[model samples]
Target: MSKRSDQITLVAGGAGFIGSHLCRALLDRGETVLCLDNLQTARPSNLRLLERDERFEFIEADIVNPLPLDVLERTWSIGRVYNLACAASPPQYQANPEHTMLTNVVGTDHLLRLAERADARFLLTSTSEVYGDPEAHPQHEDYRGWVNCTGPRACYDEGKRAAEAMAFDFARMERTDVRVARIFNTYGPQMHPDDGRVVSNLICQALSGNDITIYGDGTQTRSFCYVSDMVEGLIALMESEQVQAEPINLGNPNEISVNELLTHILALTGSDADVVHRSLPVDDPRRRRPDISRAQRLLGWQPRVSLEEGLAATCAWFAGEIDGGRVPRPTAPDRVRASVA
Candidate 1:
């Protein structure tokens, strides 16, 4: 598996949640991987294992600017490109809205041009957030979305939608082989501990035995897709010759409310965590899920891992990382003692 067949894959943001997993898969399938990452939100721990592999090389580069022409000019064959490089988490993306938009818009433009020049098959990891707060229960790929361009979450929502548009344009005008996968909520190991995502925040809070913060009335629903299932869908979409030059939805069909997810995590962790309600952030989606009928029909894909199983695995990974000193253990909140004068 370590020895690859000169099929160089430039994985933008390979040292990332889904991207890292994809890189591992490529390595297993005996394809050489060149991970192009700036390590902004990515953890080096994710790529630590792959560092020793001769076929795997990590290039600390940003796609907002042009790719290193020197590296591209050097004698190394690149046949595939997976553009997984974008600020996904709301807090991270919102921290710098302009950068997030540019990363999606300019970054895609740059990578698509690279794909065209290299004659490589391009795969874009788009987001289901493109649907915004869905009017429907489960969103289909064709849903145009009801988005607020001036909202706080617009950076991610509109950015991804724009990325999809760019991909289609490149596919048509430039005649580049392009593939798009509309990813839904995915969680697994190596996610930023404080990624400000609901799943991670809830899990960590429960593990620390703190109150679980639920935004809104906790009735808003979301579908959780295990990272492995999603990566498989991406691979299928890329490798399939029958489907091309279009967008495909990749996610789980089972939807659960925020309250339900918190209860489940608390039960799994055996933590005495209480539920706390908070004001919902502006433009926060009330409901989000993917229909995935197209994925099943065309790509023959559906999420295989159950939520329970995936969560257990994720919890165990976090536990091990914390215990082994790889990841910091979460600390309980401070308590105040009553003082009498």
Candidate 2:
């Protein structure tokens, strides 16, 4: 292990799906981790698994406000910071657009300053949504996205775009070492039961004999990367010395249409659910896929988990959640709390 591996790391959204997994991976590498989350879209149950680990610490706070740097400094010495704090799903993010915008901008700025104070490497988990309704297929790093700044999804899409701009500005002017990952759609275990993402929605609805709703004619396509694979790509990008101050696409290249994904989930769950169509939301991307050539060349990373294999694992986890009555219904927002293990 390198000497830097012993340094403390901070994860802004450590209690969320991807953030929790990254925290565990960092802990496994013998690094002390400080996880900060407000639990707005995430639940405390996600951090339950790491509660017993002495090296892991959880702080309940929102990133939209300035981070508790004083408390953090008293706790441990910061070395690397991973800013994954934001409402990812459309339904959740759209619920409070103002908060979402502030989190991506103000929250990101705070973390960048913290990174500068510690002289640590900073990584921003930007999203493919930055490339709104991409005019170019298989989006590469160089393609400037065609995004609507005033659309319903702009709070997140444009917010992330601004976050990327802020990160690069800090990198160029302040010379703060930074990494930006333009992550594509991802799914796996620990996803919120009511995350409102297509994968979770279809799987949960199929498992419970509900109609599989397909928005936008079920023809729109997305490339889904497994959570574990996505985490590996993030870590690789952060650790690589060759990649710096640039955005890299990290996702599986295999594109699947909404209808095709629904069929696969139905087969996997053995459900005879009916398929229902609905109007597509405003500014929804027609085709979503990532061009991971940069990730492959720079970080030696590409998704290794096949969709079929990854979906099966995800469905199994959702099944356990449903059978145990842990799945939250759409109408009730209070039931989204995490179940402590």
Q: Largest TM-score belongs to which candidate?
A: 2
Note the clash tally of each candidate: 0, 0
Cα RMSD of all models vs. native, in order, equals: 5.7, 3.1
Model 1, residue 255: displacement in angstroms?
A: 0.5
TM-score of each model, paired residue for residue: 0.93, 0.94
lDDT string for model 2 (1-341, tens) is 12276688889899999999899888887889899888876756779988789999998888887677644564336778899999898878887888899999999998888888778889999999999999999899999999999999999999999999999999999657889999999999898877678898888888888777788799999999999999999999888889867999999999999999998999999999788787898888999999999999999998899999999999999898888877854422222332211
**Least accurate stretch of 10 residues (summed lDDT) in model 1?**
332-341
lDDT at residue 111 of model 2 (Cα atoms): 88
Give a tens-digit lDDT track for model 1, residues 29-66.
Answer: 78888998877788778889788788888988888878
RMSD of 2: 3.1
